[model samples]
Target: MGIPVDVISLYRKACEHDTALSGYYNRNVRVESDDGPVMVRVPSAGAETMDLAIWPEAALLDAIGPHVPSAPRLMHANIDPPFQIQEFVEGALLDDAHPAGAALPDAVLDDIAAFFSQLLAVPVGELPAAPSDWPKDGDTASFAELLLRLVRSIRDRGDQSTARLYRDLGVPEDPCGLLARRVTGLSTRPFRLLHADIHRKNVILGADRTVFLDWELALCGDPVYDLADHLHKMSYLPAEDERITAAWAQVAPPECRAGWEEDLRFYRAYERMKSAVVDTVRWARLIALAAEPQERRAYAVELADKLDAARPCWIPASDTVLTPDDIERAVDRWSATGGTG
Candidate 1:
């Protein structure tokens, strides 16, 4: 299907103000309205179908608006195509404010903890139910099962390169089983709504406050999983990781922190496994768009770098690691197979 006429009209009007800021999954344009500036998000076709959530970000924002103050307020949304208009949050992205791979400032850490604490306070019973396939609330086994299902779905969808990579890295075919075996003596905690993806790029640092963006990957799961996802995605330095972890512990409810230190390792591993599969699919899509050899090489390098960093987290003792050349070969094979398994 072609772009909707209404969407085109909206884009044309938005373009009058300035150029649209392009992101990997969404195109954002700032438009001035009678009220003020509004951010219009046009999600990529791929992104709209990536998750099975009942409501998109806009709807989620509306449901949680009464409780969460650190997120953008939704003004409008179209459910069919997944387009949204929200209050334009004025601030620098955390990525722009801090250097890459640097530790976040103490003030920023405090802001994050505060936001998360407030978010956790919102009663889960008030929110919409997640799709049946999603992990069940407070069920660590279900969380592990969900991760395995995602991996299996990717492999079954003909992404053999990702499957082989997982195999070579010694990631067990049965992720749920592996998780169960590893956590035989571990305890479970209460689950809550989580902003499953909270990398630096998703955080906006305003003069006096911090705002979080991109709620597309939100989930209802163990709260520690949210912290683990954030820490891994931020790639913070060791000392900074410790400091941030300590800061979160200070503000988080006692139940949220119960056995967190012990459970964090498994969560991090799950995150790494999930990220690897997601990135493989993303890189394949990117490679298909690269018309030049240099562009393809650059994409391969990026994929290799990501895989290398995540290797230890997912499979710490594995002897197999993909070099850039190995990644290039894999990409070539994927491309040869027409990006299928």
Candidate 2:
């Protein structure tokens, strides 16, 4: 592990990066110059998404900085032991309890809709086909397998919360034989670049408007996956209105928020199920690595509470409408898993 970085050090690093400050997600001192204020957020690294560019943030800054509109300017970067310093992103994180998903006034929902619509309008294929360390098989079956492994990892560590959620949500035990063949065969097309994890937390509020953060999980494929991600990370309140939601209703030749309502439904179920499974693993890791035993205990308690809250409804259920294949997969997973991913 590297030396612990704090607020002061982050301030210096911000100046070094030639920005007002670095935003949250900086482990080694995140700060910048406001033209000099620094924003720093420190979170644990997940080994699973290591290649997602969790460490050595420079590589990510380099890859995505130019691609996204309204993103923080990347003045400088380096990738020694995995550290990243970027211009601080301004804005408040939308509250999970806030019903407005994107945290905007009702009047602003149309603008928000236009924002995402315009975002989708940002042409793809123009950028070079950048190399990525994306999984060998980026299919649903492979993804299910990854989730199952994560479940097993936590289970082995004596944290069955993750496995239990998978079980309750009807996730299969493992993506072996039949399940693999079936899910893989379902989709007949290719994939595209999707910001896999774009929750309210990953979004930053700006004077101009909302902007995204945490692009490491960015991958090429499935516009539905991106839409599903929104549902998965839905905050308690929505910053959306009819117009904003309706903005996604269009069916263009190259639909940005691609897929029919049914496709969106399928992807939502898939992504939400995966989120529950992963949250458990993440909780387990957080607890296991906590320096203080009391902290670990409290975290476990929080995990249990969260699971209980999900008993009647998982986060995405209200927003998720289902179709046949989605139902079939659910039933199939429930039958096989016996209560674990």
Candidate 3:
């Protein structure tokens, strides 16, 4: 869709007010509108340079708004030069009160489970259509294969420098192939909406309600995969993890929870392996974008840390891990190559 003049004016007003809020993929700006305060969310630089999303978030919200009222209300959206104006949510972040690794309060846990149940309750027929290549519901094997294919796509489309950096870090060229073999025997479950990236920052704790943010990463897939993703990213304490798992199972239907316990590890592994690939490319880009020596080094260090965290998932025992010096050299080499990150 073409850009609206009013939208441009709102963006200009945000810039003039210097009200841009920090985010990874978008610059969220707080601006005044006739309706009151609203947030204008515009994509960050090069957001479409990679084909990473399975569905457009605005469309998803438009379809599922009535089903999941806890999500922010989407006021307007545009595809080309993409931007979304949403109701300005007011609340403390879930992380602010219950930091990573900390067990959430009981009330908060129940609230989160309620959110998941409601989200998963959305009728498949009512949601945005999945990608043409997406697997049919309950096809766990095909779902796993599709994820591997996405990682392969990222590797193929990414710069050779990023590929070389992975090799230097001892990440196997075909870890996805290995991962495919290991993730077998997963039980099929009815497909439903999954808020795949539901970590601390994505949740807001309001006075009377808990609001989930960033529907951009939502997918239709195994319900267990959603739980596994949440567990892996949230890093809750072991006891708390068990409680949360039980809570999820209690609320989710039997079809959705079937064989979840056995399959959780495989899904977690997938999350880690994919993170290793995605973070490498992103951190390399950040390093390239850094104008100062220290900033570049900082991003390089973060890249190294991300790889190290995922080492068990993507690196082979036969291969040696990349050292800090190795990471620094790789970053420097990639930066010298001068391609737009």
Give me the candidate number with maximum lDDT: 3
RMSD each, Å:
4.5, 9.7, 3.2
lDDT of 3 by residue, 47-121 (tens): 643324678889998999999988999988876657888888878888888898676898888887898889778
Quote the lDDT for 25 in model 1.
Answer: 70
- For TM-score, the strongest prediction is 3
| Quality of model 3 by C-alpha lDDT | 0.79
TM-score of 3: 0.86
Residue 187's lDDT in candidate 3: 88
Give the distance in Å from residue 171's predicted Cα in candidate 1 to where it truly belongs: 7.3
Worst 10 residues of 2 by lDDT: 47-56
Each candidate structure's TM-score, on Cα atoms with residue i matched to residue i, is 0.81, 0.58, 0.86
Count of backbone collisions in candidate 2: 29
- For model 1, what is the error of residue 258's alpha carbon versus the real structure, in angstroms, after optimal superposition? 2.5
Ranking 1 against 3 by lDDT, winner: 3
